[model samples]
Target: MAPTPDEQSRTRTLEGVLWMLGSGLSFVAVNGIVRHLGTELPAAQGAFIRFAFGVLFLLPMLVQLLRRGLPAGTLGLFGLRGAVHTAAVICWFYAMARIPVAEVTAIGYLNPVLVTLGAALFFGERLAFRRIAAILVALVGALIVLRPGLRDLAPGHLAQLGAAAFFAGSYLFARRLSDLAGAGAIVGMLSLSVTIGLLPFALLVWVPVGPVPLAWLALVAAFATLGHYCMTRAFASAPLAVTQPVTFLQLVWATLLGALVFSEGVDPFVLLGGAVIIGAISFITWRESVLRRQRSSAVIQNG
Candidate 1:
């Protein structure tokens, strides 16, 4: 007999939690690698190597795709997502080189809020009042973290902001493609496209580095591959609603890593701002969950 709905939901929730944890750790590891590389490697080179290695790591998935054949009508969407993701990777790598890991992670939380707004505006998803309020709150939190007027923001900060926006676009495209393509295809395309996209810049800025940089680059590939794998597993196990909040744990891990590994100090404003962002994200997650449950309940009732 098939499992009951409640049992299935519970199983999915547990799996999602595990996946989110893996995602968080993978991201932290990526950050660690970036920190380790520092200025030794150009950001573009780092981005290129990271994606190139990621493609190699995902070769098994590609083989499966070859066996199954590509999905119909998804290449365009995949290409769009890949392009946006390539932009995000470049910005994120640049920011990582210039900013503290914890700060970058904190600022990166803005992506979810942006995603919510994008879904509402472009996808015609209903924008609940609570979600709107949450977005505003999160924006304020971002401003606090940025402290725009009080201090000059670095070019890296702006790059990170741009990255967050582009990442939201990538997510939107991915969500659309999810209906037509397997996750493997999405990951494969992303890795391949980003590697290709970064090639020119990587070549232009190529530095003849020693083995240490190459080692760090390889580590970056490993971390990103694992992180994405864990993320894919999480989504497979549970709905996005359940898995989303678990991602916030990344900030905590990043903070610890930044402080201990890099000897980077966190500012009070960053903590306060991060708290606000977390609270807003939590609110958004809770609201979305409630909405999803209500819709499901209604559908069941009608059935």
Candidate 2:
């Protein structure tokens, strides 16, 4: 007999977890390559090349976007999102260049926290006491990583923080796009638009990139694209609550890679901070999922 729905759901959740794992590792590889190349090229130019190559993967969807175009307000939103995302990418490269890879990854855990805060602030969602506490705990974790008074603040840390903020903005636009268009259209427009937006900045600071760094940038594009594809697959297969927790492993992989490959010291504070932030975010995801299910069940019973 075929598996029951429960069994199928379990199977899908397992697959999604695996996909998330792959996505995390792939992104780790992409970050490593970006840092490696940052030494040789301008951050903006390198980011442009990476996204320019990333656009090649989205070409299959271009015809559809061109034929239908986007809804009236969405193109403007996409433009705004693209510009914000470009800034985020530039900051990311700059951060990766100056900071340890592990530190950059740890700081990046702030994105979801900022996203949740953004929803509360902009959408008039309730900022419940529990979530507020969670945010505070995560902030404490950030302090552990930064140790502001103990050490002088590095520009790289600030840059990564900025990237996290802008990335949250991009994600907000992504959520809006999901309601307005399909995934292909959303990704295609963002990729193509960001590539175009970066072109001018790249031209202004463009330095001749040899074949080696160009190839590395191509690898960066491939790994990041694949990581995103895996992330989408993971979500398609399972609930966000099911797959989101798996991302915590990324901090582990990034830390180890930084130590082994780059000879960077593993900071205890960063690890503890990343874990705390991941724990808070995971709780928020689980709590939201439970509330959503409860609402659905209530509606069904009332109907």
Candidate 3:
């Protein structure tokens, strides 16, 4: 016999939490691998190999898509997203190689802030006062993370900031594509497009290293693939408000892994700044959820 409704809901909630945890852990693993390969390989080369391996891992899904037939339209938007994401990956990989893992992770939280700003500018999404406050708080957190006056700014930090903006654009385009394309199609197309876009740059900067770099590149691919899979599962099962908090666990995981695996020392400021950023993100997510619920309830009542 099938599970009761209560049991079904409980099962889904458990599964969603597990998926979010797995996603967090997988991304931490990816960061660890990137940090390990940081000085050993060129960032562009690492980015190329990572996406190349990601494409290979998604081959089965591509085959399945081929079997089902491709989506008829949206190739233009797909290409645009792929290009934006390609740039983001390059910048992100460079920052990973150049900066402390924890700092890069902390600065990455700016993407959500960018997303809110992007929505208002591009999609005409309303900018409520609470969201504006969250954005301001997040900006302060970013400044704390950067500490521009206290420490000399590095190119990697700027690269990471640029990458965050690119990622925000990618997310906006992705939301559009999601309506017309299946998940597999969107993912597969992204992998293929990014791989193609990165190839020339990878070739230009290519250095021949032996098997160690290859192994690290392979780990990057594996962890990222697993992270994306878990993220997809988590979103499918739960609201963003429920699953988003779990992602902040990545900062802790990154700090610990940086210390234990790479012998990188944790900065106290990074921890403090990351906490603020995470808190801001949690508030933004909660507010978005409340607004969504209110809108939905209004619709139901009106209908």
Candidate 4:
């Protein structure tokens, strides 16, 4: 017998969760490797190399896209995304080199909330009261993590914040592009565009990197690409609400990895703040999902 609709939804959600888990692990590996690289390489050069390798890894897809050509109106969006994402990556690399992995990861949780707000502002999605509240709550969580009065906020913290905001912009662009292009095309274009965008900055900060670091960067490119692919699969498999909460595990993993591997002390404030931010993000996602279902039900009933 065929499975019920509810059962099918459950299966899809489970699959999404699993895919998100894989994405998180892939990112964890990427972060761990970047953390290990430390301040040995300039952030711009490091980001450029990673994305350059990303382009290499995506060569087949790029060639395929070149042969077929891109969809109309996608090139501009891809360029815009690349610009924002290049800034995000440089900031992230700088922060990763200077800060603890867990702190960087925790601070990055603000992206989803920012994305939600961006959707409302740019995509014309309704900004409900709950979303506004969630945004405020998430901001409070960010303050808790930073505790500006208690400790001097470092440049790394500021860089991570910029990275999160820039990343949110990049995500918004990707969401728009998703409607116009296939996943492979989107990913391939991103790698190519970011590599081009980063080229000038990398040239300005040119530094000789040994073969070992180059190899490690190639691995970073592979894992980061895999993470993006898995994340796309997860979104395709189920609603955002189903996969959003799973990201909380990334913080947990980052914390453990930081403590165990990097010998970084666990900061309770970061953990607490990360939890709070994740909770707000989860609430926003859940609310959106609920409203979406309600809208669908209303449409069906009216029909």
Q: Give the CA lDDT, 0 to 100, for residue 37 in model 3.
A: 77
Q: Which tens-of-lDDT digit does each residue in 1-303 have in candidate 3?
A: 999999998788788889999998999888888887776777778888889888888899888877887677788998899899989999999999888888889999889889989989999999989989988998888888899899998999999999999999999998889899987798898998999999998899899878878887898888888898899899899878788877778888888988888788988888788778878888999998898899999999999
The list of candidate 4 runs beyond 4 A from truth reads: 1-9
lDDT of 1 by residue, 1-303 (tens): 999999988988897899889899998998988977887878888889878877888888877876887788887777778788888988999999999888898899999899999998899998878888999999999999999989999998999999999999999998998898877787787777778888998999998878777777888888777887898889889877678777778888888898888999967788778779878988888777788799999999999
TM-score result, candidate 3: 0.93
Among all candidates shown, the one with the greatest lDDT:
4
Candidate 1 TM-score over all chains jointly: 0.90
Candidate 3: lDDT over CA atoms?
Answer: 0.88
- Give candidate 2 regions above 4 Å deviation: none
Error of 2 at 37 (Å): 1.3
TM-score of each: 0.90, 0.97, 0.93, 0.94
lDDT of 2: 0.90
Q: Which 10-residue span in candidate 4 carries the lowest summed lDDT?
A: 52-61
Number of the candidate with higher lDDT, 1 or 4: 4
Better of 1 and 2 by TM-score: 2
Q: How far out, in Å, is residue 84 in model 1?
A: 1.4
Per-candidate clash tally: 0, 0, 0, 0
Candidate 4: C-alpha RMSD to true structure equals: 1.7
